[model samples]
Target: MLGLSADNHHPLMLQRVTLGLVSLVAAFLTVTTFFRVELLHHLLWSNGPENNSSCPYGHFRLVGMKDCLSWLSCEMMQSEVTVMKLIGQGAVKQVFLAHWKGNKVALSRLAVSEFSNDFFHGLEMLKGLQSVYVVKLLGYCEDHTILTEYHRFGSLTNINSILEQEDHRSFNTWEVRFRLAIEYAMFLHFLHNSPLGPRVMCDSNDLGKTLSQYLLTADLHVVANDLDALPLVNRSAGLLVKCGARQLQGDFVSPEQLWPFGDDLPFSDDLMPPYDEKTDIWKIPDVTDFLLGQVEGSDVLRLHLFQLHRDCKRNLPQQRPSALRVVQTYKAVYTLLTQESELSGTYSGTSRDL
Candidate 1:
């Protein structure tokens, strides 16, 4: 009887050991997977770009961006750049698709001599604002033409069409849209704190006009493309700037941006009240809303942004959040949404295993 009892207990002990080993392996795998996912999340969301140290232009460089070239002179641009076709035209300049040293580029020339001031202003802004947030300036011929990186995707207005294509369907996800919005906010933040002093996006009088000021890169990133009307505001000197001499009437413009005097008075630059950079802050929500697009998770994200958008549209410019604050909030919301999604996926996987 004693020998039989020992044999039975021995088999039971072996069974218990096997069950314990299996649980241990399962736990180990779960921990490993969780850590791997966390690492991936960090890598994807972190704004730091690799290979930035080698950038000779002393500006932040995006991953996969080519090395910066020396500013090309008029002779070099004229000799090397072969104009292909006119791709775009704005009030101030005409953009043509051109080939420069085997790489495609956009060559912009003053549309009319009357718009020379605007063209020169844009060129100066391009030279001064050579950062990751702004379009890459390749070369320029003062008062005549300017060359920059060519974005196949064109302006931000073409985003919907680009995403609708079958080959780019995968990029239509909310994650990608939210990333684009974040980049836009980052660009605004960079502009507001630029070395040239606090500058305002004066060209952004409406949604369409605002979208035209930015370009959509091949990699789905947004960069400031037009800076013709970017003006500086000196708050310390109590100086403010106007978007333009004309009256702007629309919900897109901030309440302060509109003509304060009723229809009883005609619009005049002398009578217009110049506004600070807060005008740009007011348009943030509008631009962000457009960038979010209509994707699977966009509605939920918009709901989350309701309060922030409301604050942005506040009647008082001072009440609105700063660009830096807006950028931080966007990043936080992005992180939260991504984590929730990952958690949901993990829970579903665990339920199936059970």
Candidate 2:
């Protein structure tokens, strides 16, 4: 055997050690790459915007994959949708004035317990809607908080309070009240004629009893703030439209709308008569009444409105006017109100000017 020189042996040993280190590092990277890819795939499957492909209008398509991940990840919610203030609270949800992506928004932060499949289903139902009179839902967080377009002027209830106070004057004119009535009628008409079908039931609590449910924008336009709370009728199944666990209440609720199911029974069953679009007709009169109480108009206008109210209040469901017909009648009434306003020089400028 030949004896190797010491210098030559050192070089050989160093080469072997370097090769071993490189091989170990390569194997470790391979394992980590496999897990990273798997984690990304799992996240895409569970929370990506691509899951909303069935959304008819492509509401989620505009958001990129990075933004979609941001929408889904709970870690980023605090950074993205920042709550500015608490605006209002309902029986089921709390409304917050929030800033999302540099735009002012309303965040409806629901109880974590209430963030079940029902809230998600409600989001699915509302995703397809595109209308001026309806509040636009921006996105949702994992914690059951929904972001919507914030109305600058607050709600119709706020307007009512301002009207009641003689000092706070902005929307107190008869023309503004008349215009509000007409616009509210048009809002209902739009909902009743939705592509999702006319069986959609606006929340009973929001419609008649509390004016706060209708939000007033800076433009003086009225938007239905509780659209997410609406109960969508199964258009395919012709099922009874339900307002979730909360039932219709007050003097405006129709007799057919009542059925005690107790706690155990499911509400989608046949125990109650199928609630039709006409259910909304019963509530439209409430808007007219609220408007009339706020303004002193001509006897002719009041009488015509009284007749319209009676028509809407008919006991028989079939006897009530359709939302479309109500819209037409209100338009005619609006024209008369406009002419009177012009004559009396009480025409507060168009909603834009106001």
Candidate 3:
């Protein structure tokens, strides 16, 4: 009537309202898709890009995403890491599935706000780790964290995904896990021996140290920022851990090969503690916590690793055990025992015949 067809007026208003609603939904989803730094109870889930189903990284906090994102600026994106699919978020980043040549790999992108002290410290330790158990190094960009290696399945953080996996290649079999733990133990021992072993060791006690970029996690990996809601992510980890079905004893250890001579020294972080290899001790037991499901007892096997972890955690760093000594104890344990089937009680006390 007002110089416009009745049909035109209805559709126009509806179209405007619909467009506004769509925009709001899109915006909500986009924000929810990234890492949140808030606590689990507080961070409410709204909407976002759909979560990755088969993405190989373990339990990831949702980070932002872009479809077929371009890498025109990053030299590696074009040449080395070919971004094929998006993974999920990390403690400080988002991840992606990329190919280095023909090799399949998972990449992590860190959140800007999550760049706190602990995150960097872990990153520093990760950088110096030239060991195999950790994620492999790769190139990155301003908006992503690139990592490479065989994308086998997932991580300890997301073990259930690998467990429910029906392919003959479930990565969470008790045996494979045994090996993964043992091998990483070797990695820890190597860290103990190397200059990169202790964080302080890498830099002399002399405060004039110029931090090495190679020693920095940020240098090794790039990330997609937005880490304002951390509590949400931490609860996510706890949930993931809770979901795991097959529980390994919290102190189940691998073979003795992981222990080394350098592991026996003491490396303390107590401001003015001496330079030594003791830090390795604390790592082993906590690592044991990761490997074995927690329970308690004196199965000589566990007590050993338990003591190692305890020794390292000691307030008086000098009292700690060495990675070197730890391995030696394993050797001694093996020497006294015969095989996996041999024993009710372990040690020189009384040989409970198998």
Candidate 4:
């Protein structure tokens, strides 16, 4: 009778154990679901201040202007901003990693007195062209000092090195890389159709130079960084612009950017024909190629972009597609590729089940 009781209790105990395990799993799943829902809600609704302007947090839209941060007086900047270390130096300014009110910021000071014109021009552009496509201008002081949001990853030039790190390896996928390419195209589109007028990326004379002109945000998106060389041209008024007085070479630059005059004739800025913003279009492929590094699906993306890029490289600037067109094409290709990948994954899973 005792042995029989023991066997009967064994089954009940086992059943209780199974029930306990199931209850624990259910509780864990419920908590996980709740947190995920909360996170989604926060991401959707808490992006910025409760205002109708739809601007990011700490930014407000001014009448007839893009979103902007509050202007920092020279006295306020000098008192509040603490310079940390020199991060970058260019012809016009020296950039420093700085701290402001417990936030990391980039502080730029005029480096060369001769380039004051360029520095002021960039500061004005930063103020006027404040948008989602460009880096956020936190504050500025007219004394040749400006402050902006600091991107820890630095410039797009450091993209490869960042991806190579173990902590960032998960971002090495083609989807992430393609998104970066899309952002770059969108930035170009924004510049070409800016509120100030059709602007050209005068600093982008080569691949390295082009990459250096943009910054890689901590979230892995690209934004226009160096606006010191942006110039406006009105096509309707028959106005054309040259990147610089100096002659440019290399296949990376558009054919029109090269010296059309023979070597016997000295390179003269007066003789060099000015080109439109399509010169920027010519460099799209090289920049996009660099953004879409050698990850899975990158080769396929390159193949898909080959024809469009070929059009971008056409000798005639007018023949190339507009920046908006390139942006649309990139987005479409990304959607198609992502859908195919998902379908492929589903099909493989179904095959395994069968």
Candidate 5:
């Protein structure tokens, strides 16, 4: 959640101020939340900067580029390689549009080839865990390439632009967006509580390790991508041919359904939130609170992401919930928001992120 008086110049120490308010206001409210200031950080959890924990490649270390990436490879995802138009290239990963089995799809690429397996692992986990609010994954490549739907509406910015351009009346669009964000949190919750993944690769290792890892793991990809080539895309997100998708995802609060309950993973200590689904639930109202003229500050969303993030950054993995639980809670919040007379009158804006 963010509040900036439309000037983009927010007040100082706004994160704490805004978070305190969120605590008071949305204490029991359910809304779609945008917690992560960036999705790249959210995905690279332990692999992010600010922390120099041992990498999963045995004992290697990881670094952050200040910003996310937009290009990716095929092996990163769990699918075969094919050319696709570049879509987004945020420092975290690259987004691409491609064709598979005659179906048009979107894919995101990561900077490090090693993390591809983990990238698709998360997607696979999400796939088995169903949710209407969360995006669906058709397939992935181990080369850091992820395949999903190429949502055409663009981001919330694009939607907001359309709303103003169309001269539409004010509506509860913010509320709905907030609700959708929370729904994703609930989705994560179900995942956290769902049966343990037959096998979850928690590292960013190389090919030989990947092969060995596969033998040790189950529910693996049917085949591997032809790693002889790199992934290509058309409209990368930020710059330099980056080609990963950016759905305006912000990793602010942890999902309510997710709890910290796993190996006391050292790398996940900094900025890395445990699996608590509550983290997701905590942040949406913060974003929505600010969005609906609730808060004030520059990059209010970003600041709130950090503030709300404080509560979710616990180091325990077992305490986390799956994405499914976040989705369910968010749905409930969205339903309640629709009941509000003010937003109900103009609840026509779309609340989806593609």
Candidate 6:
């Protein structure tokens, strides 16, 4: 009692502890409220921002926002997506089968340690597209992984291989090949005629190098799965592909892309051929050839197919027909065959129709 104050030290110490705890709780609540407000503003901006500055190019704005978001920046909750297993590996990324919400999705993971302009721009461009043929981008993870709709049957390349081996009789059917051809042409047409104007949808390597890049959905529809390979023109200003082991070569490479520097000049990265729509156009013939070789029917159909191939491979890019024209031609021939088949028993075929 002598050393203690009038109120007693016990009560005073208890009061000090109570005050400190109260202050701690209040500070915690204040900080938590600020974060919650920011999160809500980001994820639930009901009314779109009035200013352009709120949403800029290459940035991922919310669903209701005035602008879209970059794949890496999308703040997807972990509960929304759960990684299942690794499905594939590519030059720069890994593909995993993941569960997004309740549905199965493909999670393409890119390394965050290295920054890629091409990877970011590709995803940004894909985010803007809403075509039936383009795979849907669900959202993104913090680790720079991209989530998209997964196709069950794999790529066109896989189908092509099976058909080539003639392992499955159903796959070798003329009807299937014809339908695939039409769908492929239509998808390319959609890309070439995009609002962005002839954005190089598919690069030289994957366009015709192998059919496997195209995915065959469970519904039998073909989707351009390698959208990251698609490039946007200068106006969008996002990312550019880094050229390392990717040297333009084989039938996929266009005449303009061929190096004429000769043996004397040193090999330079600057010599890489700049590809455009024509580069894709050049691969059309190869695609047609592969399809025709698989299964063909009727002399008339073969002739028509040959003509389409010839037009697609015209030496000059300008001389080559556009994707729309190619689609029209294929559809016209397809309709004729369908009508004939309806009238007759079935379409006739030759051993070497293509």
Predicted structure 5: lDDT: 0.36
Q: What C-alpha lDDT values do all the predictions have? A: 0.80, 0.62, 0.38, 0.80, 0.36, 0.61
Query: Candidate 4 has what TM-score?
Result: 0.80
- Candidate 4 per-residue lDDT, tens place, 1-354, comes to 436588798999999999999999999966855554334323322322122235654464432345455566789889999999999998889999999877788999999999999999998888778776777776788788988878889899999999899987866878778777877887789899898898999998779889998888765667788999988899789899998899898999999999987799999999999988999999999998998889877898899999999999999998999998897777667656655777688212211111
Candidate 6 deviates by what RMSD?
27.1
Cα RMSD for candidates in order: 7.6, 26.1, 27.8, 13.0, 21.0, 27.1
Please give the TM-score that candidate 3 achieves against the real structure: 0.42
Total colliding residue pairs, candidate 6: 10
Winning candidate number (TM-score): 1
Residue pairs in collision within model 4: none
> Which residue window of length 10 is worst by lDDT in model 6?
43-52
Order of candidate numbers by TM-score, starting with the best: 1, 4, 2, 6, 3, 5
Q: Global CA lDDT of candidate 3, please? A: 0.38
Over the stretch 116-182, how does candidate 2's per-residue lDDT look in tens digits? 6655655555565545556665666666767666777777866666566655355566656666776
Runs of candidate 1 with Cα error greater than 4 angstroms are 1-54, 58-67, 346-354
- Once superposed on the true structure, which residue ranges of model 6 sit more than 4 Å away at CA? 1-77, 161-171, 206-210, 233-247, 271-275, 296-300, 347-354
Per-residue CA lDDT of model 1 for 1-354, tens digit only, reads 446588698999999999999999999966865664445323443442232224565343333446555778889888999999999998889999999767788899999899899999999888888766788777888757998888888999998999899987777778777777877887888888887888999998889999999998776777889999989999999989998888899888999889999999988889998988889888988888888788778999999888988898899999999988887677667666766788787212211111
What digit string (tens of lDDT, one per residue) describes model 6 on residues 58-161? 34333244545554434563656778898876655678898754667788877443646556765766666545556656566545667776776677766656
Off by over 4 Å in 3: 1-76, 113-134, 140-145, 159-178, 195-197, 200-280, 294-300, 303-313, 330-354
lDDT of 3 by residue, 1-354 (tens): 457788888999999999999999989754643322212111111121122222332222223333322222456565667667766554455567777656666665565664654344444444444232234434344444445343333434333343345642333333233223343344345445554423222211111111111111111111112112111112223321110122112222111112222435432222221223343344455544544332122244465455555665665546766555654444333333323323544222211110
Candidate 1: global Cα-lDDT?
0.80
Consecutive 10-residue window with the lowest summed lDDT within model 1: 345-354
